[model samples]
Every structure is written in structure tokens, then in C-alpha cells.
Target: MRVIAGTAKGRALKAVPGTNTRPTTDKVKEAIFSMIGPYFDGGLALDLFAGTGGLGIEALSRGIDRAIFIDMDRISVDIVKHNVTAANVAERAEIYRNEAGRALKALEKRGSAFSLIFLDPPYRMKEMDALMLDLAERGLVEDGAKVVVEHDADHVYPETAGAFEQLKYARYGDTAVTIYRYNPVRSEHPMEE
Candidate 1:
């Protein structure tokens, strides 16, 4: 895989050394950025299930000030670190090998709110709703933050997840990507598909 845009546009990223982790394909990644942002202005990003740190690294490259990448597997974490360094974005990244739940708790304690959150958990796990609720309840996401979720096209998440409202949804074969915006103000807007 490679950085598709921004400062690290062509930088190559190494995948996790096994079949357990699936890296986001360039096509889907491009589509995701198109939905939320093809670029950003200086905000923090969180990659809760960082397979190769691609999403978070992409965020950083596109202008996010900093990013935190968390993955449960050791090999994934190591690859994320190496990829971050290779992209020359190590200074703006924080990578850790921790499960989603624990990592959120620790991020809560650290007191950093993210403006962008990427959740691309394994297809078999259906915890996106719960995880979104956790982020809202813990104030881990800043108001107006955008969350990008990648999942099986057959599985549909709710129109709303806690403080986030669905903004966009698109399907590419078996993979589906949804974008949500944190609207603590409870504003109304039509969901796009």
C-alpha cells in the first residue's frame, strides 16, 4: 500500500506480516477521503483499529496536526510504527498495541479529543455502535468531528450513533464505508447514500 495523497502522496506502506490484518485498498481509501475530506486543517485523528496506520497516516499527510493509532495485534502495531516513520510522520504519530476498549479508556485519561476517528474493525465484530457510544460518553471526540467506518456492505449501522449523525454512506462490492459527524447540538441534516 502507499500514501495516495498529500505530503506523503507516494510513500509506500508495509502491510502487517500476515493474513489476519487486511489493509485498506487504494480505491476504498480514496473514496473514504472523498466522503469526509480529501484534506484537513490541523486537528487530531484517531485510528482505533489501525491495521497499517494508513488511515491515520493519511489524515496526518492531509493536514491533521497529530494522530493516535491503536491496534490489538503486536505485528500490526510494529508495522504501523514502521510505516509512520517511513512516511516521515513519526513526530505527529502515537502508535500503541492495545485493544479498542482499553485504548479508548487510556485516551480518555490522556485528555485528547479527536477531530477525526477511523473505525475499520474486522468484519466479524459488530461493535461500531458500542464504540461510537463510548466515544461520545467519554468525550473522546471533539464536537463536529467526522468519523469514518468501514464494514461489510451487508451490515448497516444506525442513522445515528450517540452524538454522531450519519453524513454519508457508500458501498464498493462487499465493503461499505460510512461517514458520521459529531453534532452535539443535535442539528438536522439529510443523510447521504
Candidate 2:
């Protein structure tokens, strides 16, 4: 796989060395960025289920200030490190080997709100609503942030859930990508000026 745009554009990325991790395809990656952003000004990103760190690295290359990558597999984590280094963006990346749930909880301690979140969990793990809710409840998602969910084309997520509202959806071959905008609930009563 390779970064499709930004400063790291055309930089080749290393795979996880097996079929265990499925990296996002270049075509889909390009399409995804086109939907959310072809580039960014500056923001923090979270790649939760980060396989080879392709998505997070791409975000960094696209001008995201920094990114945190989390994956449970050791091989995938190592490959992510290699890929980030190869892309010459190791300093802007924080790689961690931990399951998504634990990683989210631990991330709460950092108090970093993510403007971009990529959820590309294994296709077998169907339920993503809980994870979305957790990010909201923990305040890990910034207001108006974008959350991208990649899954099997056969499955479809809700149009709105908790603090996230679906903004875009597209299917590519067997993969389906859904983008959600996070809008935390605002108090109905306005504060007096």
C-alpha cells in the first residue's frame, strides 16, 4: 500500500506480513479522502484498529498535527512503526499495541480530542455503535469531528447514533465506507450574556 496524497504522497507502506491485517486499498483511500478531505489544515487524528498505520500516516501527511495509532496485533504494530518511519513521519505518530476498547479508555487520560477517527475493525466485529458512544461519552471526539467507518458492504450502520450523524456513505467492491459528523448535544437553554 502507499500514501495517495499530501507530503507523503506516493510513499510505499509495508503490510503486516500476513493476511491477519487488511490494509486499506489505494483506490478506497483516495476516495475516502476525497469525501472527508483531500487535505487538512491541522488537527489531531485517531486511527483505532490501525493496521499498517496507513490511514493515520496519510492524515499526518495531509497536514494533521499529530496522530495516535492503535492495533492489538504485535506484527501489525511493528509494521505500523516501520511504515511511519518509512514515511518520515515517525515523530508525529504515537503507536500502541492494544485492543480498541482499552486503547480508548487509556486515551481518555490524555485528554486529546480527535478531529478525525478511523474505525476499520475486522469485518467479523459487527457492532460499532457502542464504540461510537464510548468516544462521545469519554469526550474523545471533538465537536464537528469526522468519524470514518469501513466495513463489509453487506452491513449498514445507522444514519444517526448518539452524538454522531452520518454525513456520507459509499460502497466500493465488497467494502462499505460511512462517514459521520460528531455534534455533541448542546443545551437547549441558552446562557445569558
- TM-score of each prediction: 0.95, 0.95
- In TM-score terms, candidate 2 sits at 0.95
TM-score of 1: 0.95
Whole-model Cα lDDT of every candidate shown, in order: 0.91, 0.91
The ten-residue window of minimal lDDT in model 2 covers: 184-193
Tens digit of lDDT per residue, candidate 2, span 1-193?
8988899988999988777777899989999999999899999999999999999999999999999999999989999999999999999999999999899889999887999999999998888877999998988999889999999999999988876889999999999999999876532222533
| Top-lDDT structure, candidate number | 1
- Tens digits of per-residue lDDT, candidate 1, 1-193, equal 9999999999999988778888899999999998888899999999999999999999999999999999999889999999999999999999999989999889899898999999999999877988998998888989999999999999999998766889999999999998999987664434532
Clash counts for all predictions: 0, 0
Worst 10 residues of 1 by lDDT: 184-193
Over 4 Å off in model 1, which ranges?
A: 187-193
Candidate 2 local distance difference test against the native:
0.91
